[model samples]
Target: MLARGQNVPTIEQAADFVERRRPEVATLLISRSVLLGSADNFLKSFPGGTLYAVKANPHPEVLACLGASEIAGFDVASIEEAESVRTVCSSKPLHYSHPVKATASIRDAYKIGIRHYVVDSEVELDKILACVSRPLSIAVRLKTPEKSGTYDFNTKFGLHPAESVPLIKRIIDAKVEWGLTFHVGSQCKHPKAFSAAIHVCHSVIENLGKMPGYLNVGGGFPVAYGQERSDLTAYFVEIKAACSRMPRVPLLCEPGRALVAESGTLVVQVIGRADDRVFLSDGVFGSFGEVNYSKIQMTPYHLTRASAVPSLAESEFRVFGPTCDSFDELDQRLLLPATIKEGDWLIFPMMGAYSNALASRFNGFRLPSVELID
Candidate 1:
């Protein structure tokens, strides 16, 4: 997320601002209505309580919209994130979902009324026990082999089933509110992956001879960004059925990308054009960081122009960001107008997830100006 204060620019009134400005940049079009609509959808259909994953898009405007929609909670990865969520909604619960946390983070989170945490190892449990005196609720992060997502987060977090068994036992021994949580992956393509992970959770509980307090089907819910996915209604239906197979327990989910990806769009101007290549004002180091795929990954994009005479001719070209490093280029080609030129804007849709949140100030170019649409 960018700073709390920024100069909001209009895509129509100041469309040529990039050409006139000294340092070129992209523009983010965030729809407050779309964001709230997504949250409302989840609240209506999700089988259990919903928690917005703060890491996906931590923009204050987005959080405020979700808060207004009455989201059940927030899945924060860090203490700082917990504090950020509090700015919008102080009464809702905060789930510190990151498995590995600094000791200081635990202390501060405890001070801030965070009672739920995710841990995969014994050491982290020990740290939580030492820092927090109040009774705590914990969800064991279970690593899953079902790989159906665009991004694989299992390599970094979560624990294998065999590994989770001992940890679950330890949690039971400690006598705190305990549960099982698993992330099939980010932008998971199929709902079956979630069902499979839940079966694993059920098996673990069966073997342990104890039912957990809840089961968190962590955020891997898919959003339309160019790839085919089960309809949101049907996806939730499938997930709800899967959870039914598990032992009777309260269900919770932390959705980041699926909740916010469609809520925003990226409007990037063509800095200049070479033969079959276009240089954008922003690059991977900026708002396009999570677009680690070639060919913009199926999310829709369109050109904003004064004249429609050039027609909507499609041409694939290599795209580059504003950064100086050669490695800052996008993973694949982008299909835009062959007549695309400087001052012409290209708007990338479904860009809310992992876009601005992962941006950096490398080469003196930070995230682009964002306009929140009411």
Candidate 2:
């Protein structure tokens, strides 16, 4: 990985370069080793074709690193996402996994070679039928009992198991290939969530009196943050065990956060400190949106003083963004050294997921400059 202009071959060098420059904007540090390793882990262990969820982090470098691995396709929520993935990894299959889609996106996705689509209702199936003349594959998305996950994904999407049975029949009757899929939720903490969700899908299929061509256990894979640790393999084991009770079919998984979260870091400078609040260059609408949107707890930001002596007196303080808006602040408090001054750098690791994808260019604070490190 390479930093902007200082030939930073290591994270150490990158930190030193940033300290010397004292730039007003924030920096996103990308570790190619970590990114590639995460992709390799999913490709080697997941036991089936894996699709990188494009909405997680679609940066060119991020996509390029994963593209070089064994990932087979991309889980795209929109035609625009498919187009972005196409620009970098053009040959890979595209799965339009968003249960609901615009008819125009359906026709365009077909023209762009996306053969796999997911639907949660009959209206979506009709939309797909109206747009595509060629053979297509549909995956019926069933809403599973969500007991884990940081985000409430089911609030806006997902279909009830009872509702999915009729939808599955509609797809089969339409003469198109079909499958079953579910999302346990994002950043899921419970291992049993996958198994429970799979059970819901199976029961729906049993009601329909048939099994699908494939079973897509949707992406909600978790990542460790701060002191929280999880046995990721246990999730796969539980999912496999649960599937044993259902008719055998080709299995697939889509992992977003677990695949890329630990691969990047956000480097921000403390612009100011007022009482117990510390203001940073990037805030809720910037690279730190995950902290605001999902209440994701970050590992305490690491202080890098470079050649200077570190402070001994540390305390917890509220962290705020550089934006003028009052709502542009982190939901949690951060503990840092009392000596942390305006020019000091605070590094936030595990920031690759949803950071780039959700950042807004509001208030003229564009997304941080991404610097890749080897």
Candidate 3:
């Protein structure tokens, strides 16, 4: 049986379960039960708004759940991703929000009925104009500098606010229908970062002397990794306060990580142990750090044939992966119950986002199989 607490998966039980079920097969089990709760909570929090950021985790089950929960659209960066969203949840609006635009990508997006586009430079704007033939709606991404303790999205895309004005004028002069958008950064830990971006949006609208139909406050909401993060309600309150000072416009947000992380776990078997150091069957390159570049914290517990309970003391242990590469270490030292042993099962939580999406078959380690648990 699965344990009840968030950090209480026993290692011995996990190993025995894996051995009994499929000795040769290892898998990454996704807890849909946890994800549905998170998705429903987020939807209730951001009522009457569209969320279209799909850069986090695009597992088809996750997408189908989000679609059922009434997500308004999907913000996709590539053809493959757009197709993935389409495969799972069709009929929602799609935003081709990748700042850098390629000619072929634009043509494909147009053919796929993606009318909303985000452009950062005049060159990209020209590219969009050259290719798009339908009634298109565009969002001019504003280049905002990265602040300390917040994400910096300016390096990749967006025009300077001053530069944005002329772009708006040019688009208006050309009679191209467009809107305004800006991404504060990724994994933003502060609500002020979003508020500041909204303030900037207000300024842009005031200067342009026209209100676009939409304002995309691009994705940057954070997910809890080792600690509870800032409350998103407070962030939305700040956003509402900021918008109160500006002209009324439809608001949209693209949140990827906050929606999917913490709803999944990475399970690995302890293949070998030597001098208190345990090596896992999977490696970092196999299923960790495609989006968030950090090692997962291993929570080890006793899982197999149990004996009388021992004193609840802790010990520090190092964990390694089966890869031959020296850098494939999972964790150097993690605090866990002192009774861990070889052939144990170790689980790492909050790995639902970028880990699986960016995994590779390096070192001939087969990709961890995925199963959804509702």
Q: TM-score: which candidate is best?
A: 2
RMSD versus native structure for model 2: 4.0
Tens-digit per-residue lDDT, 1-374, candidate 3: 22334523323333434545543334556666666667667767762465756767777887887777767888899977888988988788888888787799999988888988888778988998999985888888986555523446676677778889988887777677778888777777677776788788788888878988788887776765654432578777777787888888888888887677767666676687777676777767776544224433334343332432322666776767678887777544766557666556656666677767777788788877776644
Q: What is the lDDT for 169 in model 2? A: 81
Per-residue lDDT of candidate 1, residues 254-294 (tens digit): 99987888777777777888999788888888888877752
Candidate 1 segments exceeding 4 Å error:
1-24, 227-230, 293-305, 308-310
Q: Rate the local accuracy (lDDT) of all candidates.
A: 0.77, 0.79, 0.70
Query: Native-vs-model 3 lDDT?
Result: 0.70
Task: Tell me how candidate 2 scores on lDDT.
Answer: 0.79
Q: TM-score: which is higher, 1 or 3?
A: 1
The positional error of residue 127 in candidate 2, measured at the CA in angstroms, is: 0.8
**Pairs with steric clashes in candidate 3:** 11-301, 12-303, 12-304, 13-303, 13-304, 52-75
Cα displacement (Å) at residue 89, model 2: 0.8
**In model 2, which range of ten residues has the least summed lDDT?**
1-10
**Can you tell me which runs of candidate 2 are displaced by over 4 Å?**
1-14, 17-21, 228-230, 301-309
